[model samples]
Target: MQSTSNYLWLLKDILGQGATASVYKARRKQTGDHNAVKVFNHVSYLRPYEVQMREFDMLRKLNHKNIVKLLAVEEVGSTKQKVLVMEYCAGGSLLNVLEESENAFGLSESEFLIVLQSVVGGMNQLRENGVVHRDIKPGNIMRVVGEDGQSVYKLTDFGAARELEDDEQFMSLYGTEEYLHPDMYERAVLRKPQNKKYGVTVDLWSIGVTFYQTATGSLPFIPYGGPRKNKEMMHKITTEKPEGTIAGVQHRDCGPVEWSKELPITCRLSEGLKFLLVPILANILEADQAKCWGFDQFFAETNDILHRSVIHIFSLQQATVHKVYVHSYNTINVLMDAIFRQTGVPAVEQEFMYEGYYLELDLAQQVHLVPKTTEERPIILVSKEQKAPIGITYKEPDVPTFPPMFDLISDANLAKIVTCAVHQLLRITKSIMKCQDFILRGVYWMLAILKEECRKTLQRAATLNLKLDFCKSTMMRIQKIYGPHSRMNQSDGGDVHMKLQLTVHFLATISQNVQNSQKQLDQIAAQWSNTNDIHHKDSTIGKVEVLLEKVSAIHQQLKKDRMRMKLQYNDEQIHKFEKLNMGIHAKKVLALVREDCEQKYKKLLTCVKDWMRIACDIRKQLRSFGEQCESLHCDLENCEAYLNNMFHQIPLKLEGDQSTTKSTASTVYPDQKCMEMAIRMKQLKQEMEHVTKELQQNNMIIQSLSDGQKPQGV
Candidate 1:
C-alpha cells in the first residue's frame, strides 16, 4: 500500500497481514529510528470508515506503558493509502512466542505470571477510562525488547474496542470464537434474546480462556465443529464441569464424532499453583455477570494467592521461631532483612535452607525471590555453625507491631455510604408501614366509639318524642337501676333544674376547650403539610392530588350555587325560632340535659377527627425528612456541616420547665422545647376558653330564668 517517499518514514519488508491491513517494519527518514506502520488501502481496507476511525480515536486517547503508543497517522494521496505509525515491538506477538515454544508448553510459571500481571494492569487502566477492549487474546498482546535485551508485554489491536457511557450495556457480538465468552456465543450463534446485552465481564472471560490455553498448550473448548457438533460445543461451554476435558462427543443428530485427546490444565500444574489458579479461574469463568470478579477484586485475590505468602523461619542458635510474611515479587535481600529483624540476627550472618540443601549467600543476595521448592513450601533460616533440621513445625503468631492510625482509617467514600443508606431506608420504610397500620386501627376505634354515641343520642331523641307518661316511667326505670345514688334525685339540694343547669354549663365548657385545642392542632398540622408539599414539588403523586383537590372545590362551589337558587324559588319554607323563657319545668330541664349531652358528644367527635388528621400530617413530615436526609448523606462532604448548622439554629430547651413525662408520641420536632412550649400555650388558651364559655352559658341560663321561662333547648 506504500509508494516511494522521502518524508518521515521509509517502508521496509512486510511484517504481518490481516484481512483489512498490513504491518511493515519502517525506519524514520530523519532519525533513522525503527517503528511499525500499519497501512490501510483506502479503496477496500477502509470500508465503512466509521469503525476504523473509532479504533484510531481510541488508540490516540490511550497513554499507558502497558498499552501500545500510536505515533502518527499518515495519508498518502498518490497511493490512496492510510498508514498508522506505532511503537516498534521487536519481540513480536505473545501468540508467536507461545507458538515458537515446543507445543506451547515451555513457558515457566514465573514468566506466565509476569505476562498475566502486565495484561491485567493494562485492562484495569482501560476500564477506568470507560474503554472496553472486547477482543483480548494472545495475538493482540505484543512483546517489546528493551535496550537491555529484556522484554515487556503490551496490549495492542483496538479494532473491537468500544467506549461505554455510565451503566451502559454493549450488545454487539464480535470476538474470537475460540476465546468468546459463553454468553457472547449464545448471542451470536444461538440468537438468544435474553443474552443480547452484556458488558466488560466478557473481556475477563476471554482473558481466562487465553490464560488456560497459554498454560496448558491447548484450547479449553475446541473451536472446530459442524452444525450438530457446534450445538454440543455450545452446550459444553455453557454448562461443563470445571475439572474435565472438553472433547467432542458422538451426538444422536450427528454420526460418530472424534477429537484429539488433551490433558486438563489442573493435572499439569503443581498442587500449590493449582490451588491459586482454580479459584481465579472459577471466578473469571462464572456465567453469571453478577458473580463475576471485578478488576479490583480479582487483583486482590491474585495478590493474596501468588504474592503475599507466609513462611516459618526456625532459629537453631537462639532456639526461637519467627514467622515471616513475604511478597514473592520482592527481592530476596528484602526477605533476608525481614528475617534478620524478626530473629535479632544480622543479614550477612544468616544462612537459609530449603528442602535438602543450604542456599549460597551469593546466589540468595542476587535473586529476586525467596526460593521455593517445587511444592511451594516455606524456607528455613539457621546460623552458619548450626546444621539444617529435617522437619519444621510452627504456629502463626500475632504481628508484634500495630499499624499507624492513619493507615488504619478505612477509605469508604460517598458512593459506599449511598449504597448503605439505600438498604437502611428500605428497613425504615417497612417500619413506617407497620406504624401506619396501627394508626388505621386507632381511627377505626374512634369511629366505633362515635357510632355508639350516635346510637344512644338517637334512642334518647326517640324517647323524648314519646308520651309524658312514658318519659316518667323511663326516669323511674333509670332511678331503679342506680338506686338512691342516681343524680336524677331531687333530694340533698340536687334537684333536676340545678343538675340540668350545671350539666349545660359543663357541656359548654368542654366544647369550648375541645374546639380551641382542635384549632391549635389544625394549625400545626397545616404548617407541616405545607412544608412537605413544598419540599416534594417534584413528586408526581403530590402534583396530581393537588390538581384533583382544586377541581373538586370548584365543582362543590357550583353545586352550592345551584342548590341555593333552587331553595330560593321553592313554594314553601320551613323555619324555627327559639325564644328563651325563664320558667323551667323539671321535665323540660331533663330534655335540655339530654340535648346538651348530644352536643358534647359531637364536639368530641370533632376533636378525634382533628387528632387523626394531625397524626397523618406528622407522619408525612417524618417521611419527607427521611428522604431528604438520605439525599444529603450522599453528599458526604457537606452532610455533617449542614446537619450541625441545622442543629444550632433549632431551639433545644424550654425556659424554666423540666418534665421528663412530656408526650413525645405525636411528632418529631427539632427539639423537646419547641413541642413542649407549643403544647403548654395551647393548654393555657384552652383553659381560658373553657372558663369563658362556662360563664357565658351560666349568664344565658340566668337571663332565661329571670325572664320567667325555660332556657332554650341545647
Candidate 2:
C-alpha cells in the first residue's frame, strides 16, 4: 500500500477476506510497528458509501481493549479504496486457536471463561453506544498475543453493525448462515421484507452457537453438502438442536444424546459446576427471543462462576468447621436448604449468627456480605437460642419521623437542616465535656426544664406574633387562626386552637429529639474524651456559611435566567392571537411548546432559590446557637467552681465528733463566704434562664423561617 498523509504502509500477505473488505498484515514505516489494515472495495458493495460512513462513525466513538482499535482511516487516492488501520492480532482468529488446540487438550474451563468475558465486555460497550454487533462468531473473533504471553480476544467486523433507532426493525438479512438465529434464518430463506425483524437478541444467539463451538472444539450444527451449501446449513440451524460432543480427542457429535452427558467436557466437571452452567447455556439457546438471556443476566451468572469464595459453617460451642468451602453466592436461605440435607433442620427453625449478632432473616439473600478476602472476618453460624461468646449488645437507632413541613420542603433544604443539627450537637458536646459531670448534667436538666416553659411562652406569643409580611392573603385565607375573628373574640377556638396545639406538639417533639441527640453526643464525647483522642475540633459552622454563600450566588443566576425565558403572553392570549395566522395549527403548537418550556424553567429556578434561602437561614441560626452554647459552657464552669469552693469551706466530719457534727452543721450554715457563693450561684442560674429564653426565641425564628415567614424585629 502507498503512503497516505503521515502514515506509510508496507502491506504483507492477506490475513482474512470478506464480501466487502480484506484484512492484511501491514508494517508502519514511521513507527516500525505491525498492524492490520482492512481495505474496503468501494465498487463491490451495494451501498458502499453508507457502509464506509457507518463503520467510521461507530469506530470513532468506541475505545475499549476488547474491541478492535481503529488506529487511522485513510483513502487511497485515484483508486476509490478506503482502508481502516487497526491493532494487529498475531495470534489470529479463535477458529485457528480451536483447530490448533483440538489434538492437544481442548480449551480449559478457565480459558473458555476468559474469552467469553472479553467478548461480552466488547458487546456491552457496543450496546451502550446504541450499536448492535449483528455478527458474532468464531472467525470474526481475533486473538492478540499479550505481553504476558497469553491470548487476548477482540471483537472485529463492524460492517454488519447498525445503530438502533426508537422502536426500529432489523430488515436486512446479514451475517453467516450457520451462526444466524432461527428467526433470521427463516427470514433469509423467505427473502420477504415483512419476515425480517429482530433486535440485539440475534447477536446473543450467535454467541451461544460460538460458545458451543469453542467449548467443544467443533460446531454444534453441521451441513453435509458440496460447495455453495448455505441453504443446507440454514436448514440445520433452523431445525436441528444446537448439540456438541466431548469424546476424548474427537470434537464432533458422536450420536444423539443429552448435551450434559454427551458433552465430554461436562462429564469431567463437578456436579455443582454442571448444575450452574446447564441453566445458563439453556437460557442462551432459547428459541424465543424474549426468553433469551441479556447481557446483564449473562454477566452476573458468569461472574459467580469465575469469582468463587468459601464460607465456613460451625456450631456455637467450639470453632470447628462443619461445612467448609461453600459458595459465597449461596444465600442464608440456601444455607437453610443445606441444613435440611445435613442435619434435618427446617429453614424456618434455622437462624444464622455472625460476629456475635443475629442476622435478620429478611436480609438472607444478601450472601455477598460474607467475607471474600483473607483479611475479612469469618462467617459464623449458631442456633436462635445460642448466646454470644462474650456479652455484646447492638445499639440500633430508632426510626426517625419527619417534621410536618418535610414534604413541603426541597431535599436540599432537608439536608441543610440535618447538617445544621449535627454541627450544633458537636459544638455543644465538645464545650460541655470541658466542665464537671455535675455541671454538664445541671446544664442538661436546666435546658429540659426551660424547654417546657418555652413551649407555654411560645403558645402565648403565637397569638400576638401575627406580623405576617410573607404571603399574608394566602396564609390568612388558608389558616385563618390569626384572623380578625380570633383577635376580636379574644378566644383561642376552632382553627386557632388546632394550629396552637400543632405548634406545641411540634415543639415537644423537637425537644425530645434534641434530648436524644444530646445523649448520643454525650456518649461519643465521653468515649473520646476518656482516651484523649479528640485532637481535631470540627469547623462545620464555618464550612456551612461558606457553602451558603456559594449556593445563594448560583440561585441568583438561575433566577435571572428563569425570568428572561418567561413567556410573553398567557396560553389563552397566544391561542387567540394565532387565529389570525395562515398556519394556525403550526403557530398554536409552537406557542404551547414555548409555554411548557417557560413553566418548567420557572419551577426549576424557584426550587433552587428556596433551597439556597433555607441553607443560608439554617447556617446563620446554627452559628448563633453554637455561640450560645459556648457562653453557657463558661457560665457552667464558673458556677461549678463557686459551688466547689463553698463545699470546701465547710468543716469536714471528724471521726471522734459524731455528736458534735450536729452542732457544727447548725453553726456553719450561715457563714459569710458560703453566703456570698450561694448569692453568686443564684445570679448564675438567673443568667441561665435568660439564655434559655434567647435559645427558645431562636428556635421560634427558625420555625417561622421554615414556614416561609419573613424576618422582623422581635
Candidate 3:
C-alpha cells in the first residue's frame, strides 16, 4: 500500500477489451508475478488517463487484506492508454460466480462472509483515506483463489471513488445501471445532464447492490434496466425487508417465475452478519441519498464489523449509552409520485393569508385537483421513514442575515424539546387533562410500536440460564398507571383513545410479522403441533421446527411488555406533539394562541393543519357533536325533539372521557380555560332556559288538572 509513479503503462501484448477499459494480465515486471493491468479510454469523457491516474493514486495509498494491493503504476512516453498494475484474481469476478450458479450459489455463511468482509473491508480502507468509492458492484469486485482452494475477495475499479474531506451531501448522478443512489436518479431527472453533479458516497449504493447479489445471488435491484422497470426490485431493497438474512435453504416456486418462490433460507451466518449487512445495504440503496448512509457512516460501520463488535442493532440500541437513532427517513411521497396521483394545486384568485406558512397555487392546478373533492381527499403523512438524520444543519460558507431553511431533529435533540414541552404543558394546564392527553398520544404510539414491532423482533436477551427481566417493572408502568383505567379494564375514553392510536400503529407493524409468523407456523403448525405427523425425512418440516423455536421465542418477547421507557417517549404521535409542537393549542389554546391578533391566531391554525396532514386522529364524538349542532341549526323543532329523545335514552358522553383524541380536525385554536369554558357554560344556560319554557307548559297543564280534579273527587 505504498504510493507508485504518477502514471502507469501496461504491456500492449496482454491487453484485452472489456466493457469499460482494456484489461490485461501483467506483472510488476520487476517481480514478474501475475498482476492485472487496467487501462482506461480517455478521449470522449474524462481524459481516460486522468481517471486511471486517480485510481492509481487511491489504490497505491489504500492498504487492507480485503483490498487488492496496487503494486505499481507503469509510466511510458506518450502513453496510448493508462496502465495500473493490481493483484490479479485467478478466481475471477463475482459475476463469473453468479453466471455459474445455475440452480443457486448455495453459498454458506463462511463463504458469503469471505465476500462481504472483503467488500466492506476494502471500502472501509478507502473511506479511511476520505476516498468514497462511487461505484461498488460484482463486475468491479474480483475474487482471488488462494493456495488451499479458498477464495479471497478483492475490490477494484475506483474510477468513480470520491475523496470527501468535509461533510457533503451527495447531489449528482453516477454509477452502473442498478447501483445509482436515489438522489442520483432524482437529480438526473431534475437537472440537465450537463448540470448534474454527484458525490462519492454513491460507491456505498453500488456496494449495496454487490452485497445483495453476493449474499442472495440476485441483485436487490435489477441491473441494465431503466428506473421504472427496476422500481419494484429497488423498492424492496429500499423499503420492504425479508428475514434479515438468507443462507442454507433452497427455494421452490410458490406462484410463478416472476413472483419468486419460497426459497430455502439458511439461518447459518452469525446473526451479527445479517444485522450489519441488511440495514447498511438497505440504506445504501435508499431511494433518497439524503436518507441513506453516507461514506463517513459506511466507513464507521465497516470498521466496526472488521473488529467483530457487531451486536444485534435492535439490542445494541436498547443499551443505555443512547447513541442517537440515525435511521433513514425517506420522503415516501416522492417515491410514490407515480401512484400518489398528482392533485394540482389551484391558483388563489385572491392572495390568501395563513398563520405559519402561506399557499401558492394556480387556477389550472386547482381545477386539476378539483375532481377529487377536497373534503374526502386521501391524507398524506410526511413519512418519517423517508428522511435521514439532518444532523446539525451545515453552516454556510458565508454568514448571512437570512433565516435558516431547515430544522434538524435527532433523539438527543428531540429529548430536550419533548422534555421542555411536557414540563411547559404540564405547568400551564389546570387539569393535567390536556397535558396527559398529549403525553398519552406519544406514549401510546410508542407502546403501539412496541406491540407491533419490538414484540415481533427476533432479537433476544438470554444466556447463562439468566432470566434477566428483559422488561422490568418500568415497562409495565402503563398497566400500573392506567391499567385500572385501560379499556379492557373499564378505562375512560381519554386513555382508550391514546392507547388505541398507539396500539394501532404497533399492531399494524406487528401484524405483518404476525402474518409472517402465522404463515410460517401455519405451514408447519400441522407437523409441530402434532408429533404424530412429524416426519424426520422431510427437511422442510425440520426447518419449520427450527423456525418455530425462533418464532416462539420472538412471540414470547412480543407478548412481554419488554420495550424500554422509550415506548413512552419515542413514537410518531409524541414526536408530532412535543418536537413539532403538535396539539399544544389543544392542550392549552388560550396560552398558545392570541385571540386579539388574527395573524397569530392563523399561525396556530396552520400548525394544527400541518400536524393533521400527517394523518393523526380525532375523536368520533366530536364529529357527531358537530353534526348534531348542524341539524339543530337547520330545524330547531326537529332538533329539540331529537335532543329530548336522546336525553331520555342516552346521556351525552363526556368529550374528555370518550377518546384520546387530538384536535387534528380543527386548525383554529379555540380559546381555552376561562374563555372556552365560559362560552360553553353560556350555551348550556341558554339551552336550559329553552327547556324551562317546555317545563312551564307542562307545569300549567298539571296545575289546571289538579284544581278541576279536586272538586270532582270531593
Q: TM-score of each candidate?
A: 0.42, 0.42, 0.36
Over 1-714, each residue of candidate 2 has an lDDT whose tens digit, in order, gives: 565553445456788988888888877767778888887765545685676688888888989989999999886666656778888999899877865512122355557767877887888788778887888988899998789877789999888898974245576778887678778877675453455478777887788778766765655555444112546443443344443221112123343323332444322222334445566666776666777777678878877765754344443212222333246667766756654454344565455444444456553674566544221233334333322221111121111223333121232233333333332222323222322222222223323433443343344234223322111222233233223654312542343334444544544454454455445435534543532322223333344344334433433333343445443456323322322221232223233323442233233334323322332233243344445434533443443344334323222322234335445665776465456555655764565465446545654774675465755675
Indicate the TM-score of model 2: 0.42
Against the true structure, candidate 1 reaches a TM-score of 0.42
Task: Rank candidates, lDDT, best first.
Answer: 1, 2, 3
Whole-model lDDT per candidate: 0.52, 0.51, 0.41
Candidate 1 local lDDT, 280-364, one digit each (tens): 7767866677777776777787666546554555543343334455565556777677777766667776765555355565534
For model 2, the run of ten residues with the poorest summed lDDT = 390-399
Q: Quick one: RMSD of model 2?
A: 31.5
TM-score of 3: 0.36
The number of residue pairs in model 3 that clash at the backbone is: 38
Candidate 1: the clashing residue pairs are 581-709, 581-710, 582-704, 582-708, 582-709, 583-708, 583-709, 583-710
